[model samples]
Target: MTASQDIISLSNPVLLEKVDKLRDLNIGQHVPLPQLVVVGDQSSGKSSLLESLTGIPFPQDQSLCTRYATQITSRRHNKDSVDVRIIPGPRALEEHRKHVEGFHRQVPSNLEFRKQFVDILKTANERMGIRADVSSGSGTVFSEDVLKIEICGPHEDYLTIIDVPGIFRTTTQGTTKNDIVMVKNLVKRYIKDRRTIILAVLPSNVDIATQEILELAEEFDKSGERTLGVLTKPDLVLEPSAQAAVCDLVQGKKRPLNLGYYLVRNRGPNSGLEGHSELDKIFRKHPWADLPRDRVGIVALKEQLKSLLVAITQREFPALLREIVSQIAECRREFNSLGSPRQDEREQRSFLCQIAGAFQERARAALTADYGADSVFDQDELRLITHVVNITDVFNADFHENAHSLNFEKLGRSEPSEEVEMLSDYDGVRKASSIISDLRTLIKKANVGVLWSKEFVELSEIVTLGNTPMPMPRDNFSEWINGIYLKSRGLDLGTFNANFIATAFAEQSRKWSEITKIYMRRIIVTIHRFIAAALRSVCSEEQVRTQVWEAILQHLVKCYKKAMDQVDVLVEVEHRKKPYTLNRQFAEARSKARGYRATEQLYPKARKDTKQFGETQYVVNLDDVAKVAEGKNNMEQLQEDIHDILHAYYSLAANRFIDNVFQLAVDYCLLHGPSSPLKVFTQDWVINLKAEQLERMVGETKATKKRRSGLAKKIADLENALKILVS
Candidate 1:
């Protein structure tokens, strides 16, 4: 090495060494690291510059250096040593990483260093699955894995420099279009970090405007803050004008950079200039002599890079320390969330029991509506009781608003338009048309006095179940009731038959089946959703989650079927059995309904008999009113009474059924029983399972194990990095 190259201390050795250890710990994969990274276009003289700086001869050929990045780290130590290893990329497979990590070689000083170093790189390439020859085509042409070479000596400068794969625009025999994009992305990944000092390499012969490396550097560091341009092969630009342009760039006369540009003349394999002293002779003549002395040679470039790297490290160290502490806390939380690994059958069983206990605790919280401070309960779908009650409230409102088969007020106003009646017959029964006509006549007279009771008026304001109500016009309902009355009529002549009342009540409630099905489906879906969310929180492994789901599915199906059966029974009793309720609300409803027969329309109005005494006069006579009342017969009054009775009984039975369904079918069977679906997964259930079943139910998957291992390694690395920064 030249005496001028060693003129400056490379860096504060202690600070750079600390950062180097942190980089070696691979915490940079989680966060950015402070270092110098070399980036340029393909064939940009980057390798020759690195060889000049490190005094380690890199392969002069372009094929070997462009495949992967190389990291050269130098440390000041008591003994001289050189060790080489491969740090696998994030995408490397487990077996590939294992094989690559096992590669280690100690370069002996007795042998030639360049040959040994190049041979080691070739071996590392094969280990990384990159083909030796292009035509062989069995492996990749480029990789993200880094080749790490560490040098330690009594007088070595403590520094770290990374050479990233050169960016390429086209593909060759072994490389595809994908390789072009891959190389660019790899370079960008390295230079994008704010802590990385970019050494943008440019060949002096190429047009500066066309070089890709400067464009990228400008893109990432838009302020030109951390980039330093290195112009190589200055002797190749022989023209006076072009040489002045290069001199102008070096002096910041053209495109200015914060830390401007440096010019270096490196010795190629075929170049006559064998050393730095020989190269200095050419710069002493002609146009290059006009440039400043500090920006002209390899030694000056090294000193500038060393000083810049040290400055960046000193400025970013505290921020990096805070970042490490933050990462340690976050990674520790994620690692703990994965829980302890289960290795054997006993451990798997115990793990399953723990999950089950957690499941039961959350499930109990849902069942009782006891949502405490846990964020999991914040989601509406997970709160089982609240969801069930909201749906039940909708069900109750739906039944009250739309359960009855008839709307009496609407039917009374719009009577059937057809008038021909009293002739058709089928199956030895009266035709529905004749009954409709007869019933319409009665409704027109009875509707004047009809008014909705207080209970029915309030039910009108409640929201429906978002479904269209069953259409039963008054004429159709009257026809149906008359048919029932005829069939049930017996020894009761002047009075109405009570048997038809049950039949009318049963017919009005036929919609209970459809409405109940909708309600039950909602409850089942809510319970199933809550179960899935709870299981996901408790168990991290997908296989175990699936097994637990299968176990719960069986119990869930049984519970739903049982609940539906119970619901069907409730419907059956309402349909097949007699209509009966001991509540006093029935009496008030019956009295209100009977008032329809005595409307003000029944009274006769007195008309002017004659224009008396030159003025119009009106008179009210008792005889006229008595005659109007006497026109109606016993049969009409009986039909009106039966109609009123049917309406009163339907209202009474509907409210009773709504309460029973929410309590018995929903609460008792599916949500609260000993065999409830919510209680299917428990510690008792895990204890009862066989060893093989437990193994299948709770065993950790390969992906889970791999993730846990990765997190454990990351946490250890971060903790170590924190210690290095603090100490």
Candidate 2:
């Protein structure tokens, strides 16, 4: 008879109840629920050992591949019954899930379960065919799906043992060199979970070194902390020397384990089932069975496991309470993160409204700088109206400062020669031509250039021979006005014209259009960012969020393209075709340059032989002469006059161009073109959407929905368990 026959009730019923709650809820996925994980080399009699321990019928044909993880959980109960479930692992195949789900759907209720289970395993494998190569690095891959069997019957000890697929050393027909690594990884994953206690099953018939399970156990649970060594098929250890070695291992004489080894006799893989009487006859006759009760049989191993589990539970219960609370909190956070589903049509419409309202409010706040006190950046909080006024001030300052900073001018453009030929040597004209070339260089550059007539250069380079000369030289007038262009705008009346300035202005206008394009891009990018933020807060599903983003982006692209095309059309059709002509100041400068043919005719001078006072010198200032010459304008004064007018016109027009560019960006790109990205987002795209189209666009996948619901239910289950544990 088995050892449980004498036991009246479970010694750790509360612990068993906790384990049941964890298993039923599938809480180990979240918080690593504690258990025993069984692993061993192939043909190590792992299946028989599990059956004897739990008294549950499992797939036992040696020819059939175990291809998946099997979890066996059994407890003593009033009646005999078995429950079977399939849990798809993380690496489980999609076709495998379909096969399993299909089976669950079509399975008959009144059928004999044990026989049906064998057929179910067979059907699942046939549907989920094996693939040897999964990746370049991995040689052979298989399913990690778990086949869980929960059993309850009279005289069964409460236990949960996971039977992993057997480890292999060599390549076979359906397995490869990679299969050896894959199987080991599968075993390690189960046993590596901290809450799991390792059960390293081995065959006494083989060398202990070949049992890879023992090596892995020592590697993961060094010092045998949570490891139990179980030796199966002791009857097969027929040689006296092999028997002595197995006996020494059980008694802890050699290679001592903290939780020592135990020996059991069972058929490893025969076609028919063996009754306990046949095993009892062999055990009664065998010399190894006489060693010790605690180290020899399945009954002793069951008792040992119960005592060990009880002690481990006592030590781990406090941590388990903490784990339950932690897991509950984690699940709650994840559930809230998933948010309430938008299954209702009204809910979808309301989400669009929220996105629309947030967009407009944020845009208005940005324009008005009314972000209330919680604005993150000081820059974001700055008033846009104030920013515009400040930028205009900067524009005005740049206009005046750069106009004064002309790099090319009349200063020293000519030098004095010692002879009368100096006046006609064309030195002044050569100097004037060089000055014009410099002006051309500064045409589109920020540092502009201005010029004056050669007559002006000749007049400025002169000097009075002596006071005996009755009238002062015209050179005096030029000397007085050397730096006049610094304070006042001046031009070479004899050389360039207003049309030249207009062509220069056109170059600047073209550059301005490129700059404005950059501005347009910046505005569109800012709006794109706002649209994405709006989408994230409104759309729950990734597919829907992506749809909204693409719609808005494509809309903006079309709008901006049209605006840019209009600018090019405007430039070609109207702006450049009109003939650039001279204005009033340009015409006046032309007349002045022709009249003042000689430098002597430019400024006021003393009378030929003045006797008003003996040798008293008096020269009229050209500034007054300039005031006088202003009304009596000549060629020299034309240079300064034209310069003044050009600056005035260009400044006004440049500022106006800037204003036009900015207004277009605000109106067409920001507020209205193609209704703007933000406005477009709020539009009823769903209005014309077909039922199937809407489903495809916004509907969640079955797997995603299942995952979300599963997490929520797990959270609730954990919370309830946490309350019980804590109390």
Candidate 3:
């Protein structure tokens, strides 16, 4: 009787169940799964060993020796049963896969199961289009499809073994030269995986060095860690020398393996207790008995394989689980990128409607500054209202800095080499005066190259020059307004002309149009960027995103043009209309200016005194000052009043005009109202689209459909894989 220890199975049910679940899900196609693959040369007892292990009668005829690989799975169950199916290979076409999957059979595990099992194999071979003999060349010599056989019984050991086509050197009547190569390549494909434990079956009668399976195993597993040699048909070795060589090979004295070797006797078709007894009797004789008792016979080999499989499963399970989880995540991402299926007009329109609705919600949220905790609003570019407000603020600063005609603080001051002719209201002692008495002395001592032009330099540059001359001589504010005052003087004898004030105010605010237009352009660009990002987030299809963009782009262009037209009208009003204001500040400013004492001194005949030594002084003719003060225009008071009114009115108008640009041009035309471009994508707009337009916008390609299908299948497989590992 076989020792109890020799028949003990080390199979861990939990680990083997996980492996079986993954295998059934076909997860091995994506990631390598731990397996025990039986590979050997032709007639090397591979079929015999598989039959003994699985308790299934595999065909052993010379013509029917595993034309394609067979996956034999054995499980312990309450009753005896056999289930058979086909697992199509990677290279199988869709049509071929359907046909192969249709081949299924259930055989009763009774006395006649052997015959029924053989018939089932024959039927599977026919379904795969593998001919019984290739002499007539009607069918293929080999196939990538696999025959799956599942055996369940209370006494069966839980295991899975793949039996590939046996290696052959010569071409027979049923096999050709190409067939020989195909068989070797097929066998290599199975054993080459690092996760696979290679069971290299070798006949004891054959020379060990000449076996191709062992050489192939060594090629992939150089360290011999995963390769386990199985010396079969040990009873066939009759000679003492051949038997000694077989014993030496089994003991690892010759061509040593890391996993060592096992010796088993082929009991032909006998299995169960009868096969074990026959195998034990053959191993008891001569040199075979000298071999390790635990490394001989069918029972010991089965238990050893169970132990090795369980050990490798525990070793590689963590990494395999990680790979499975990684694959699941990647597959879901790709599947999502393809979006939901849209095969017909209804589905396509529904998909577009969903995108349009999402876009509208996001646009509203962005424009209203109602940013919830959504990550989409976290990006600065997507904050449309915030971006527009910032742009408005920058425009306000730029307008204040560059739009004014003069710097009001430096209005009454004279330039270098210039003198102000004024009628002084000074008392007995000297007061802080705006007059520079010696013009030529100051010009000579100045460091800058001063160009005393008859008029001012660029108004923008003049405003920037602090305490520096504006390249103009004499009183800059009075001089600037004197020209306009003279031209507009009519019946007003004591007061300055009102028309001149309007002209000055118009010139001061002229740059508003240009600055506002620049701000508008920035807002338009920000809107376009937001539209693009929102579209991409909602829908990934290029065709859909592009078509939707086109629909909205025309509207955006029109909105910008309308906004610019409105701005032009506003600027035109500021330049052409009369300077009139109900603002109390303007009236208060005029009254305040009239109440101040006259600072300007009219020195009609002022001569520089050369005899003053280091102090350059001017000698004033008091008699000529009286004559100049009595002139017609009263230009001194006229200039002072005009300066005050211009400063006050400009401040009031600047604030009003900036608010108008933001409300009428940006909010009404581009951002907020019904005509606004941001309202272009809505559910109503999607519903109103024509059938042809919807089709053009949402049509899907065949390749996209195929890719989506593939990814979906992958995700399903990987999800099943994850569940297997987790459970």
Most accurate candidate by TM-score? 3
Greater-TM-score candidate between 1 and 3: 3
Q: What is the C-alpha lDDT profile of model 2 across 33-110, one tens digit per residue?
A: 677788888778887887678754555654345666787777777876676666666544557666654543123221
Query: Model 3, 126: alpha-carbon shift in Å?
Result: 2.9
lDDT of 3: 0.74
Superposed Cα deviation of residue 171, candidate 3 (Å)? 9.4
TM-score of each: 0.68, 0.58, 0.71
The better-scoring model by lDDT among 1 and 2 is 1
Q: Which stretches of candidate 2 lie over 4 Å from their true place?
A: 1-11, 56-70, 79-154, 170-186, 236-240, 266-293, 314-361, 370-550, 553-727
| Clash count for each candidate, listed in order shown | 0, 4, 5
Of the pair 2 and 3, which is ahead by lDDT?
3
On a 0 to 100 scale, what is the lDDT of residue 132 in model 2? 26
The prediction achieving the highest lDDT against the true structure is 1
TM-score of 3: 0.71
What's the lDDT for residue 336 in model 3?
74
Native-to-model Cα distance after best TM-score fit, residue 718 in candidate 2, in Å: 6.3
